[model samples]
Target: MNESWMNEVSARLASLAAANPARDFEKNARGLLSSAFARLDLVTREEFDVQSQVLARAREKLAALEARVAELEATAAGRVK
Candidate 1:
């Protein structure tokens, strides 16, 4: 985190705050800070959504495999009896 870069960011933020005078400046500033920190921290919404879909598909496939396994086990049990 370079001091110059921070200064640049601060300048840009000040410009933004000045531009939106009608809004609650402090709240908006906090929100912007939070968003920037979140961006720095990983796990964006798009990536999360993609992983969620993948997990759902995996769960569905697991359910189907479980059902098939149960059927096979039942069939084998019947033959043994």
Candidate 2:
């Protein structure tokens, strides 16, 4: 039904692209995009997620350390009173 129609259209398009200059244009476009992307600083989703988790853990540890320091300072001030 609809699936067979799509398959036939895809086959026709593939045949036309193979025999046409469109194939070379598509290749050149992909190469240009890849070159541009390579020139930019970028991270994969997995790397970004890992770094985000690391930063979150560091923040939590920093908060705990700050609380500990505040408690120690208060205890010292009470003794000095």
Index of the highest-lDDT prediction? 1
lDDT of 1: 0.83
Candidate 2 C-alpha lDDT tens digits along 2-80: 5775575556557666776986757755665566556566889999999999999999999999999999999999999
The lDDT per prediction is 0.83, 0.77
* TM-score versus the correct structure, for each prediction: 0.52, 0.72
Per-model root-mean-square deviation over C-alphas: 8.0, 9.3
Model 1, range 4-35, lDDT digits (tens) per residue?
A: 85786698688877877746777777877787
The per-residue C-alpha lDDT of model 1 at residue 66 equals: 100
TM-score of 1: 0.52
- The regions of model 1 sitting more than 4 angstroms off are 1-41
> Could you give me the TM-score of model 2 versus the true structure?
0.72
